[model samples]
Target chain A: MGKVVLVTGAARELGVRFVRRVQREPDVDRVVAVDAVEPVRGLGAASFVRADIRQPSIGTVLAEHAVDTVVHLDAQGAGPEGRAAGRAFAKEINVIGAMQLLGACQKAPAVRRLVIKSTTGVYGSAPRDPTVFDEQTVPGALPASGFAKDAVEVEGYVRGFARRRPDVAVTVLRFAQILGPARESPLAACFAQPVLPTALGHDPRLQFVHDDDAVEALRLAAGEPRAGTVKAGTFNIAGAGVLLLSQCARRLGLLTVPVPLPALRWGGGVLRRAGALELSAEQLRLLTHGRVVSTVRAREVLGFTPRRSTQETLAAFARERGAGPLPPGLLGGAVDRAAAVLAGARVRPPHRQEAERND
Target chain B: MTDAKVIPFGDDEGRPRAASTDRGARPRHRPSAGGRDPRRGGPPLSSVPEQRSEADALPPGRDAEQQGPGRQETGRQEPGQGGLLGRVLGDAWDARAARGLAFLRRRLTGEYEVDEFGYDEELTDQVLMSLLRPVYEKYFRVEVRGLEHIPSAGAALVVANHSGTLPLDGLMLQVAVHDHHPAQRRLRLLGADLVFSLPVVNEVARKAGHTLACAEDAQALLTRGEVVGVMPEGFKGLGKPFADRYRLQRFGRGGFVATALRTGAPIVPCSIVGAEEIYPMVGNSRTLARLFGLPYFPLTPTFPWLGALGAVPLPTKWTIQFGEPLATDAYAPEAAEDPMLMFQLTDQVRETIQHTLYKLLVRRRSVFF
Candidate 1:
């Protein structure tokens, strides 16, 4: 029962939340929060270790603390800086940091469990994907670059390490586009704007998991080994059902700027420069034929049942982000939001599950 | 890095029929979206970001109580619900405050659900198929020969010969199956990448449950016991000159037979008599076809000359005949692997359909009878 948990990327809110969450477990003897930068948020009683996980120093920190479990959250999306730096920085931290952390976990005898947050982007959105992707659905097209590619590489390392450490329980949670009150996912950030860009012909379906569910899933994956609990495997954590891009844009009081595919690539760069969007090639692929993850494995293997559905999670994020602090000049964003709602398209809402008698 | 080629394009060669079918199937959806369907081949209009009142775009008839799943069903808002002034004032207050009501207002008002395959059944039935009903039932006057052959329930593979220069037969089959089946079953048509590659056609095809013509998708649907329709001839049967109508091009590796054997679902051979006469592809321009990214550009008597009016199909007095189900339940699931059996079964289904087409064509029935 003496669990010493070390959490990486503890400077971020999601990382901080994991640190605090692990600390509350009665069996967890100590919680070590490590990050390259000092955390601005309060960490309660958890000890803070300031070291970049990419450095070999992180291995020493793991050994010294006798970390029995390592929750890796350092892999993340791009930063606020220009597109080039943001992508480069994210790659270094996500791939390199993950490799170093896995190395440390491999050497540390005390580490029994490793839960690293991953994404469904590893599946790679394509026009020809299997209708539903279980964990085993061979990723149709591997991610080329951006956070998606980073996650793919990170997962590759994690899988490699799992083969070496037969004693360690390595769990990978491939989360769908996360959305919540202040849960800054790349997709969420896209919605943070008053206007959303979409591929002209496609209204791809989307899936989301709430922040609270993410926290719970992380904790469950690292929970003290139980007799009948979910075993170690890659699981997809997503809310049930999906929402269309048009529906999302309308719900957030935003105007959908339908851009043709040919012009979209150039437009993404222009918007990225103007501070209007985060238009990565990966994100654009997602926008064109949005990804949907099967939550069946997440439920059966990871023992998770999210409290919020995709619509609810997106609605909450839309609500919170729509109310975010903006300059007086951008108040017009609110009016446009309401007007889009008032003039929403004539598309009919889906038949309620109970009412879908044909199925 | 998630690279550029996610292999978004489906490589299923036989999925060629839906390009014509969906293009034909699209008349139901165009007028509703204010003509924004990118497949209509208009200039991609970049929505101008000008100083227009947001109110002009706000959707009407949305209120707080309608926040639940079936918000659109009940036409009237709650009795105590206020009007546009209340919403604008609430929105105004939301604008000033950090935690404004804007989020709640939008969140609670409208929510649309789409399935895993990106299909919106509510949209398909209410808007799409309904729009095509008059044209399908009246315009073509499509007659059915064997509605009784379709199983009222359970998974069955309905394999048909793909035809019509524009493949309007697929939609007619979908409508025929949907309208005439005793249990009111729907045919989940498997389309090729060509259909998904088009602009508006892709969106409508998906909503209408036309996915990639692949084994994985077909198996998943069959496992769930849903009826699946496949045009085994693909583009060869559809794009063949009118002279080759009903000849039944080789059914590519007998994929449908293998699919049926693997799933143990019965196979129903379907034949259409009049689709070959619809567009009447007398000739095709190779250069024009390459330019338009289409397999071939048809030179119909009226098309390219009549423009939009020429796009309309002639009332060919169509006839669809569904034959007896060829049982695959006798084969082991592993039987899908045997090439000899698959080849024999494929030829059997092909011969049955071809013979039936001849029989139907000769039934003292003229093209417009």
Candidate 2:
């Protein structure tokens, strides 16, 4: 018989893709998709459990379902709502919820593999040059208040559990920038907005992993049978190449305004002084030093390959609902600007409308 | 012979002393080079014999002298009698003839002896030091106005400017003291938390004896009367990009000065040159970095592995110059409490290093080492 998998936050982008990929895999017989909200669409052959994963009783419900591979991915404080909710909420959900899920997995004797989605925020803001962060680099100083509290609490629980339960294989994938469909990530929103120019050009390089690859990473985590602290064991799930924000903005048809580092430093200073941007003095240090992650271990241990390029991935995303004309920044040349207009022709609004009428 | 002079680089004043006829480190009149008579060179304790006699006994099975002193001797017959390549070929011929004789003696039953690569110190030091000099000359080269500022003896804190660039400045400083300074004292550098955590790298670093650049480690090393190095900027200075390279990052409330003030070690301001040009981080992606729990995205030329890991670090030349020591011994025990004094001292050290680096840059005629 194939193994059953339970995924919390099934509605979220990473969790949704996880369910889809698992269901397609021959080894996975069923995926028990859990979420706070009901699934808008059904996952074939997979059971859907709508419940808040943070609650204590959620574990009993998961145990009753006979989940064998519990891929826990429920949490909040990810998006804009993250800042509004006080520090305690971040700890309660990202941390407490994770602990509760692990408890549930332990209760369910059938649950063999527990895969937790971890963020690279644990590495903190130290400058490490040419040093590949593998399953060794510990989380440096906490940069921001929210990230500091959440990353610590989650790692602490997972680490403590790994020691006690050597039988249950636990994999914590510290993922880099995640990008895919249905991602209302702040960047995606930024892309959708009619910003003429992106601030601070040539300041930071970004790596984004497509949603499919993100799911593949989760699947790999489920298959692995190892019991160790795994340290950061982080991977740069970013898209195949690194690109500047100006380049991305130019490609996305947004304004490519270049805010030099000096100006930003001055502006940041003023903003901090004026209480416009709330960042600690230490946090500001990280703003100037660029962050880079190595995905070497992911290929070695997880057998993951990111198929989508940043350009293709962004193009597909730009086709999402109400994502009309390409932004001005993306209109690099006159020829490309014309091509972008033509690219919008593939939007297929008529086909959608026809399908809606048929339904 | 008169004692050899100990001159700090950028010390323009003429001083009289004996010059070394050999390449080896010569002794100076000042007693601080561990009070070992200037007449004697290296450690007085003879290096454990080339081959520990079997009958003389062993320390332990694992401690069977894993490669350092004995192995190097057996491996290389001093090169330049006919140069490195000529010696290798000559050795290979001898091995070949010996193998043929052994083959006949064993009636062709014996296995062939495998040749393994061994460490060549003189060659390695020459290559590594030459490769590192350019990086040192560009950013760290400083002018020492007074050679006498650094005491002839005891521990000293080399406080200097800190910049962003992954503590390349710190490493360059350590190499400078070893390679260029007259004393050739091995500067024990204190590293940040991130550096010690990396794999493969962590192994090489531990062998080099780098501990966390924490106050405890610095104090401990200094208390042993050894030179301890630190960069007050911590993460802040290291993270800065090329545009902000020389600009000193915040000193993190001057804890390093406090450490020096308490220890009574003179603070030696060290200026590092050429570290900034190694890699240029052009852009950062905060949104994406946050997803992965990282600080910011770095868009340097070789990184993001534009194909292979070899593209990681550009072999930039390094030059590090140590400045006149900032004396903290005269201060009262509670002197660390004076923030104004600490601030002034930090600025002075930073300015000195910065000025020295600019002067060094002017002296450097080329970009690549």
Candidate 3:
């Protein structure tokens, strides 16, 4: 018999999209979509169950559906909007909701597989951090507080649940910064700005996974182990290669103004107060040091490789946003012309040759 | 030599004039050329006088018309200018200018690629190396020896002595490897975490292909077949007083050896002379160092008293010698874990560097020669 899958955070766009994709999966007999509020659009063949996972009522929804697979994606603070809802509310939905959901999963005997969507932020950015983080690499500095902390706590509860239910195949996918045409992540919001403010003296290496790849990775984790795929384990899900923040800014045709670290923090507060892009402490650290994770395990064991590389993912996102004020081609042409003019002038003077010969 | 090849062209252009002016400028450049000792085997220095005479022979107004864009295509009125020599020179100059412009365009458009570690190979080669080349060539007059010991390709660990209060030696060593080696290999230096913690230094260090002196980064670079350089002495050797110059400090915990053993890359002990005399750290202030959060506040003879001018490193002749490689592949795979094996290997490497330093010191004629 095909398995009954329950996906949390169904009202959200990513959740709705994931629910639609999972409903079409050959092994998924039924998809029970759960969220605190009703989704705006139809979930296609999947059934939407409006039940908040923070309360014990989520247990009734799970038991009623006889969910054989649980994809817990309701952990908040994944996007800027979630963070804008206030820190406490996001934490309650993330930590408390995960705890309640995991508790319900532990009691459900039919749930043989559990997949939790995690963020790479758990591996906090620091000066001493390893160049690339694999699944086993410990974070250089554990995040004090932020969405990263929430994810850490949620993963802790998931670990507890896994230990309690050894029979269930638990998969935790730590996704890097997710970006796509439809996504609205903190990084995406930062990129959308015409003028990007970056931390001074930092051109951090960044890794990104396309939103479609993220959903695909979740699907692969939630489903049964296909041929050549590992049954269950934690995997870092990110596209291949990396991009510097400066390179990203150039690609997006955005003018980046470098602000000192302290002033950046102050400016972030001011911007947030004015209902602009909210730069959390986690994001500030990320902007400064950046984080990159290795997806070798995901490729080798989980049998999932992202379709787009980091550069390609960003390019696709830029394409969807249309042309910025300064298109890359125009900027490149202007630079090339300016450089040609300068070089022509330098090589023009015969006396310059005498000066060079003297050196 | 490159000088001999250029002389034929100079003779063709201004043979009579060169002979007349050669005598006058020849004596003036001799003293400067003699400053570099001939016993120190390096790139031939005889080219300096020949090139200087060639430049002196050229009439300053001869190429005035060549500056105009219209005159570039049309043959010069002079009989010698229309030959293959002039065409080749003009084409070469245009090509170089075009290449430079293309590089600028790539940098502006962010079209270049950096490795996962943020090492920008193009920038390091085209910009950073050229910037440091003058100091490496003219200022220090670095003479490199035993460069053949480095493999033409594949991974190798270079353990060198660290000195000079400001760490200019590391950069000079990088230049030495890049310019002198047969393979023209880039040295990826393993630096202290403090170098990475700072603001501007952090960005430049990464761009110049220096990573934190941690085992993970070293192993990764070695596995990728990069020539990794590490100064095990770190702050200890760099901050030592003038009295301790050339006395090798303790190699820290044999970590580099273990890393080499694990990766099975041969360890090449490099001894760099003249770096110790650059700043000549006479004393260190603990209070100032603590207040500034520095390892040591160095007090040199010319420093603190000279203010900003004190930062200029003394022009001391330098010689870098790469010793024979110590093979780690012969050892058992688990040998890296054995503390005894690591200690023996580390000691062997350290002694080799210290011994070579003494030898180079004895051979040196003078510090500022």
Q: Each model's C-alpha lDDT?
A: 0.74, 0.54, 0.79
DockQ of each: 0.18, 0.01, 0.35
**RMSD each, Å:** 13.6, 23.2, 7.9
Candidate 2 lDDT score at position B159: 67
Tell me the tens digit of each residue's lDDT in model 1 across A91-149.
Answer: 89999999988988898888899998999999998877776788999966888878999
Give the DockQ-based CAPRI class for model 3. acceptable
| Better lDDT candidate (2, 3) | 3
Q: Write the per-residue lDDT of candidate 3 for residues A1-359, one digit (tens) a residue.
A: 99899999888778888999999898889999999787757899998888888899999988898989999888766432533477788888999999999998888899999999889999999989777788898877899888889999888988888899999999999989889864635687778878888899888889999989989999989887889888588999888888888888888888888998889988888887687765677888898888778788999999999999999999998898765666778877876776577466555566655455546
Tens-digit lDDT track of model 3 for B335-369: 99999989998999999999999999999999986
TM-score of each: 0.79, 0.44, 0.86
Question: Model 3's DockQ?
Answer: 0.35
Model 1 per-residue lDDT tens digits across residues B232-289? 8888888888777778898988988888888889999999888988888888899999
TM-score of chain A of each: 0.87, 0.73, 0.91
| TM-score of candidate 2 to 2 decimals | 0.44
Which consecutive 10 residues in model 2 chain B have the weakest lDDT in total? B110-119
Model 1 ranges off by over 4 Å? A80-85, A323-359, B1-109
Q: Which stretches of candidate 3 lie over 4 Å from their true place?
A: A78-84, A336-359, B1-91
User: Candidate 1 chain A: minimum summed lDDT over ten consecutive residues — where?
Assistant: A345-354
